[model samples]
Target: MAGTAAVVSFGTASAQTAPGPAGTAAGTTITNTAQASYTVNGVQQSATSNVATFVVDLKANLTVAPLGGNTPVSIGETDAVLKFTVTNNTNGTQDFILSPIQSLLGGVFAGDNFDVDNIRIIVDSDGDNLYTAADTATYINELPADQTRTVFIVANVPAEQAASLATVTLVAQIAAGGDVTRQGDALVSNGLAANRDGVVDVVFADNDSGFGDLAFNGYGRATLAYEITTRNVDLSIAKSSTVISDPVSGITLPKAIPGAIVRYCLIVRNATTLTPARNVNLTDLIPANTTYEANSITVGGIALGDECVLDGLPLSDAGGTVLPVSGITGSYDATARQVRVTIPTVTSLLPVAASFRVKIN
Candidate 1:
């Protein structure tokens, strides 16, 4: 019976304990002490046979580095490269999924203005084609534990959107089944999880150094004055009064007639610091009752007109043409800082005043 009981116990225990059991129990004591001792030993042995299972510990290691022909980007341009390294730090291989996140701007003028297109990930291990869902077979390839993989990325910046500095980010995740560990025939998995996040920044320098440091002089204060020189001019008439009689009348009649001319002179000066004195024009109003035989007149040897007259004689430049005057109807002198105009004759005209313009410089 003892041998039979032992055989039955062994069979039952082997069947229950193949996969491992949580607890062990000793058989009840009977009249035979040897059998009880054997049962207690079996219980102790069973307890020792139970094994505690622990899940495998998995970790990820990642690094990011900027790469490209044009590392320091300019405004409104493209064609740059970014490199990243991913490592599996576990007892077994792991599968990973990498995606891009928004990077932060850095350096002076970093955020002045910028734009970025979608990030492109290239898996060199997978034949260097652009990463996409169809390429999952190549991307999911096992990265042996304690091993690293390099990934290449292409970055593009529009010429117009370039700035002094810019920032970018990338995200990496571990796949569910790929992140599992086996301890004592039990499996532990971390499921899907974010393994790493990275940031990168680019910088640029100012192009213009010194632009707004030139000196300039503005308009200065102006001084003005006027002087009247000669007040009149000599005049003569070809004929004098004469006596005449009507053909029918025998008696003769006497008549008195006269003719005369008047001239006036004017002087003006620029007294202010404003350079290049200008001419001041003056007009004399002839009274209505005044009479003149002829209206022709001259000033400083120059003929005068009813609407406008030169201040002095008609001056010419080296080219033989009339010298340009600053004032439309008046005169201007840079050195003399004065202007002079003559009114030769005035008769039966309304009161008028001279007007001119001046600039302070």
Candidate 2:
């Protein structure tokens, strides 16, 4: 008498135990067995099926998410940093290839008008969630399952960029993990009907992350925006009039009456900004029934108490007068009765004042 051994395959039932983000670990061996008792052996004969085992395949998955909504940046800014988080959801350790892509006109990030310059991808080496000179690793290395790493998209804004908004997407591609010193090759899915014996295969189970990235591609992506703030110089004009002398009340308490000399001051101030205001031109018209005071126009005057001290250089009434020290130009038109002053630049540190005198008719 001899005992017979039989083997039954349950590929469908065993596939449920494959490795995944939350399932069994990759390279783990799973075994199953089947038992049968035949009627011919009613006296008590049973046969045990052989073991059917297969190694759990690797499931590559990851997710990328922006740390915040929008990264506000100013024009001509350099080394601007945008943050993101990359999580390894695979059942085993993995490496991620990081890349930054500028978005097109529309899609997940609507109204994307410009592209950033000098774009680069960098991993947070110190786990501080901030970009520093010490953080220089470009790709994620040996990131364990269920662990997250911070990443940065560093770029520079163009000096003459006119667009107000720019969008960038960070894409992380799953790669093999093992070596800690160098990056590994990118993972490719092994499409097979049955799991290979004693071998670890790969399967992509990631979800779509917009920007035309589809699921099951071992790629995860997230989008961030760079919003340009209004950093141009803010120019403010303040005008004040002071009577120099009057016929009835001379110098002590001047009044704006006939035959009185009056000075009109226009102060142009530039608020603090990234850049200074240039080509600042100011114009003033003589009041009705008033005569222009010859050679009365002063440029770059300083404010003393409430009156514009004529500390600035005087201009010739004949027109086309340029101040040598301040580079300020002034002109007067007798026919039009107008005074014009042109300043090359207005900065935040000081205010430029243009004052002219007119006499009552």
Candidate 3:
């Protein structure tokens, strides 16, 4: 009793524990605290409380990328597929909606000559990075954190397009709840008061990854784009004249003079870089003081209306068929002094020439 009355030890306030929160980044912050108390000499004494705090760090991060990069396609190509991938980093469940854009041509804003037709969005459920029989979904639904889903944009290319650049763009937006079919509401940072503002609940990004921003009161979105290149169809024309005869010389030769019969040969060429040209059309203006000879149209060395493909034709569109042209027609516009030729089809493998004799007046 005498020793207890002499002195009392003051307990160090429970060591003032300061613990950092754990199981963070899920969506909410968890706080914890502890206090120290003791009975000294039959009297109760209290000490300051020890507290620890940590954020839940609940956050949503999204990223998109093209699969296999850009690609080159031919005109009239059907079911062209543009592939992409979407990833969710929310540490929880999330969904994404899909949208398309066509503006990413060579120019920043100018649209290309053609648009992708019959476009469809496909989801890769098996993580195979391919649109397979096992994968069947219209949109992404309730994806897990750090997981990826493959997507494909399938469409048709229009026929008869010149060589040019094109693009297939895709946009993704977070949907309300876990509905990939529909967009989710926006998230408000105002906490409980912000609920039901048509806004969906979303984890905000605590750190900066540039994929998305902290959603204080909004939704998350991302974009993935790909380019489609088409080959160019080039057509060229060449013209020359050969002297068949002269009124003064009365003989066919390589000389130009008054009364000379000039056989004009026009060579039309299609390069091998692109698809064949259909319904090829040709026109020429008759020179003054020159009279045009009648029926001067030829294709691949074969004359118009020829019953069979002849060696005389420089290029044959018959695919080795006996006849290059089923039918050929031409007209001399005497009123306008012009010559025109029409062919059903023309190929790029060879040059076709047409010649008509014109007499100098």
- Per TM-score, the best of the predicted structures is 2
| lDDT comparison, 1 vs 3, better candidate | 3
Candidate 2 RMSD to the real structure: 14.5
Estimate candidate 3's RMSD in Å: 18.5
Off by over 4 Å in 1: 1-70, 74-77, 103-113, 126-140, 177-361
Q: Candidate 3's residue-wise lDDT over 1-361, tens digit each?
A: 0000011011100000111222233545456778789999999998876666554433554555566654456666665677777666555566777766654433432334456678888888777676666666777887776666878877776665453445555555544345556645543233444433223344444232222223222223223332344355577777766677777667635367877877666677778553565556777888888887654444456433312123243222222322534545455677887777665555687666665568887
Q: Which regions of candidate 2 are displaced past 4 Å?
A: 1-21, 33-49, 103-109, 233-361
**How big is the positional error of residue 333 in model 1, measured in Å on the Cα after superposition?**
57
Instruction: Give the per-residue Cα lDDT of candidate 3 at 115.
Output: 62
So what's the TM-score on candidate 1? 0.29
Among all candidates shown, the one with the greatest lDDT? 2
Local distance difference test values of all predictions, in order: 0.29, 0.76, 0.54
lDDT by residue (tens digit), candidate 1, 1-361:
0001000110011000011111111121112122222346456422233333332233222222222221343333333445445443333444555554333212212232343554465555554433344432323246664455655545565434223333343333433233333212212232334322121111111111111111111000100001111222222111111122223332234222222222322222223221222122443333343332121222332222222233343422111212234222333332343332333222222212222222211
Candidate 2 structure quality by residue, lDDT tens digits, 1-361:
1111111121100001112344677889999999998666458678999999989988777767778666777676778888888888788888999988774424334456678899999899989899999998999999998788999999988766576777776878999999999999999899555667899999877755243566578877766777787557678888888888999989978888998998988998888654466668898888798998888888767787446967467876666555466667888888898888888778788888788988888
TM-score of each: 0.29, 0.57, 0.45
